[model samples]
Target: MRHAETVTFGGSGLDRAAALRSMPDLMDRARREGTALSILLWRGKPLVQAGSLDQLVRLPMDHPIIKSGRHVDADSEILLGREADGTLVFAHDMSSWLPAGLEATSLNTFLDASEQQHPDLPQDAVFAELRRIMTSLNARDAELAATAKALYSWHASHGFCACCGVASEIAQAGWQRGCPSCNAQHFPRTDPVVIMLILNGNSVLMGRSPGWPDGMYSLLAGFVEPGETIEAAVRREVMEETQVQVGAVRYLASQPWAFPTSLMIGCEGIATSTEITVDPVEIEDAIWVTREEMAQVFAGQHPDIAPARKGAIAHFLLRNWLADTLD
Candidate 1:
């Protein structure tokens, strides 16, 4: 776990200027001075340049699309952080705007087709799903985009104050929502999920959910319930899903999974029993695969299994486990 922070969306030591966020005219100053760097989102997808999919395209605060009132009147505007060079970074959610007369495509297909319709924006810019190309992005861009997506998602769902059931106003530079009626403050939430590699001798326990792509299996994972520890969550999840008791859970690494914001706590657990009683409600299938079989799956040689998605924590833990580097 020495290299744990190298995981995707792990903190890269960006300067999150908390003090600047409290200033009353922060957004106003950014708009007038042109000293802001804006990350653009289209219905929760980050904007990327067309040809070079690896690079993320950031818009200047004064750019045409950003200035065109749609972004100025964004659904949720977040102050992400500042750079070492003193550039203010922000995120503008453009989920409310759509290209006129353009037929809506599935989230999977919008990435490739959206760029062709928008002639007003940069010729190379296209909105793409973050999960599809997370590993290709550099550390800074990955962190910023993940932060933006998480914040936007929180705003979309949590419009009302939980304490008083009153509508809340955005405050504290998008980190908080303030309720005037009850004087309650609400903060962003990150649910903790335990994803464990359960080991029984040389084999590992893997499971696939009902709707996952065919042949896609990953490490057993479940959310940490109220007052449950990470270790307990891992053991309970494995037992509940596959009826296999786990012991000696050890922390491995973690990643910020921003598909609506969940912190994946990776772990390795030793299984005490080998019974395979699959819970049909939770998982479609569960199996014990040896290291050799996993290697074949990773190399695209396995007949009936697809490897875990490349940028996910499951894939990272498995790769390190195979290399004997999961210390």
Candidate 2:
């Protein structure tokens, strides 16, 4: 846990300007006086330059897309945060725009390699999947992209009041939804998930869900249920999935996983029982991988297993484990 906060979306200290969220006058001045810029997201993919260098595409507040009131309406402009130069940054959703020759089936897949270009935008810029380019982005861009994606996704699903079942309106500059009928407010949610690194001796416990590609294995993980401590969730998840008894759970690091919205809490546990009993309902396979084999997998030389995807907390934890830096 030495470089714990170095994880992706760890944070870049964006000012956020929370005070301006409630001040409509300041927000309006930022937009009207050319002090604000916005990042565009089309179907959850952020606009980025198409090149080896990863750069998030930022557009002006008065950009045609925003002015057109198609992709982003007045109420939908989400205040992401502030830049170092005192520039206000916002997030605009372009989910309404349909690209030419857009393949419906190709999107939101395991690996969405396809990129979409807007006719109104620059030739070098395209909306690409955040997961594919997450590692390429710097800390600031990663944080912004993750935050915007999570906020927009929350708005899409929770458009109604849970208390009264009536439609709610955007409030607090996209940070909240106000229920007019019941005076209730809803905020963006981040579910806590415990990803466990269970060790019996030299080997670690890893598993693969049913849809994962062959040769890909990752640390066993499950959502932290209501009223359960992180340690208890780790033990329960490990025992439930693979029937491996875990003891002595401790926190390691965390990552903001915005594959809709999840906070992956990395933890380590000592496995008291290592006998494998695969739960078909939970995971397709489970096994204890030797440290040597894990090193091979990370090197892409393992004959049977592939390494966890880079930039993920699982890969981060396993790499640090290999390097003996998880102190």
Candidate 3:
């Protein structure tokens, strides 16, 4: 898609400097050079210096304020990277520290709060704030969020080792949890979800899950079950949701949806049948809308339909598809 990379959290071409991830000497040198900056996460919500660039905020490691919030112990290592200017970048996990206004709330509660308030957080103002403090964030922020949230959730739910039912300890910069009793190593997990646009000429299939706001519809999606390929998942999900037979499923794009780590595998599927049989358990409704109708929905002019939420892969893929760039 021509504007695929232009989307928020799309490829920003940041030079991650991956070779340095394992080199302690190089990492130390970069840290001492004052090029090392950290992005702070308060209860999984990235800290934004109100009115800054994109969503960028500062995390100077040596700053007096940060030193006062020394939650990381000497035994813990942080994830580090390098900026284009040879500066070091790090991700700081403040899940240990109590977040302001969130001291008594659990992580799940915090996430719920963020979701409920996100639409109200002035987007342009937040982007402006992020831009003022940092030039840009690497596309990997989405990946990192996915990794961290998945791992953290795993640790939260799997405090006991699966091998021996013993408690596990966080290790390897929060990447792994070790079971002292059984020597078991546990890692983060990601669930694969297939979101497909099933097309029959000019119209595309869309559905809405129960409980979603009225008039909201999106591409049919479902989790890829064990031993299922992406193509198989797309076909199965679409068939299961709408009883619409799909053929020739092809990959289009992907997004890391980190509401506890899901990889959204976007695809295009050719419809072999148009007859709709809604799975009342899986979806509340299903319908096909032509390109012209889709254009109206995107423009918020459809009297009975609402467009997909911005910044979501559904909207991203739909926009590209309408522009005939879903190549």
Candidate 4:
């Protein structure tokens, strides 16, 4: 775990100026000082400029063309940061405008086309574009995608205030929603998920859900229920899914899984029992694999198993585990 922060989306020293959230004058001053830039999001996807796939594609703060756009009004933008003495830092939304490749395309159609090519886009490029220019963005692009997807989904479902039957207004830089009638503040939520590598000497346990692609097994994971501790959740999830007894859980690392706002807490657990008895309701299959077998999966040489998806914490952890770097 010495290099835990080196994981994708794990470390990026961006200054998330939290103190500037409430001061309007400070934010304006920051913008005027030219230290502010806009990250644009279109339909939840960050807008990446062509060819700048490795770095954040920031928009010039004073770009005349962006300022003249009809939909580029003040309300569509949010101030994200300010310096120590109060300076405006901003991010703008161009979701109302067409993206680079889809100038005349509809959002729905554009999404469909993009999905088809998603697997082919360079990981760095995809990550760079979404991290800076999108709503719900993170310092890492994939994390941003996950954040945007989750937050937008929440907004879509929680349009009405839970405390009172009134519409809520977005606030706190899209991180919260407020109900005017009931005076309630609702913040964006991140669910806790425990994903663990259950180890028995040289072997590790993995499971696949029913709907997953063939041979797509991953570390056992489940949501941490109310009142459950992380170690307890790891034990409970393993028992529930594979009927295995786990002991001595050790924290490995964590990733901000924006897939609808989940925080994946990765851990390693010592298994007391190895008999596989998968609960059909929880997992389609559970198996113990030796490190040699996992090496094949990672190298794309496994006959039946596909490698874990890139950008996922599971993949990150497994890769490190294989390299004996989980320490």
Residues 7-105 of candidate 2: C-alpha lDDT, one tens digit per residue: 888858888889888998897898899999989888899999987538899998898878888646446789999998989999988887877777663
Colliding pairs, model 2 = none
lDDT of each: 0.85, 0.90, 0.67, 0.67
Q: Per-residue alpha-carbon lDDT of model 3 for 1-327, expressed as tens digits?
A: 545565544465555565664566766665577767766554455555353233545556675535555753332335534556766666654556543464454344311423111222333322121111222444655444334445455556777899999888876545567899989988767789999889999999999887677899988899999998999999989888889999898888777665656778888999999999999999999999999999999999999888776667888889888988887
Top model number, lDDT? 2
Residue 98 alpha-carbon offset, candidate 3, angstroms: 4.9
Where is model 2 more than 4 Å wrong at Cα? Answer: none
Provide the lDDT at 166 for model 1: 93
Query: Model 1: per-residue lDDT, tens digit, 121-213?
Result: 687787778887688888899999898899888888899999989999999889999999999999999999999999999999999987677
Count of residue pairs whose backbone atoms collide, per candidate: 0, 0, 11, 6
Q: Weakest 10 consecutive residues, lDDT, candidate 3?
A: 126-135
Superposition TM-score, candidate 2 onto the true structure: 0.97
**Runs in model 4 lying further than 4 Å from the true structure:** 63-76, 79-89, 93-157
Task: Report model 4's TM-score to 2 decimal places.
Answer: 0.79
The count of backbone overlaps in candidate 3 is 11
Q: Write the per-residue lDDT of candidate 4 for residues 1-327, one digit (tens) a residue.
A: 997766556665444565666666765665567766665555555545345433444556666635665545344555444334433345555445443566554344211325111222333333223323332334454333344445664665677788987998877666578899998988777889999989999898988887676778888899999998999999999999989999999998888765456788999999999998989998898889889999999999988777666656788888898999998
The 10 consecutive residues of candidate 4 with the worst lDDT sum are 110-119
Cα RMSD for predicted model 3: 5.4
Pairs that collide, model 4: 1-327, 27-88, 30-87, 30-88, 40-133, 146-258
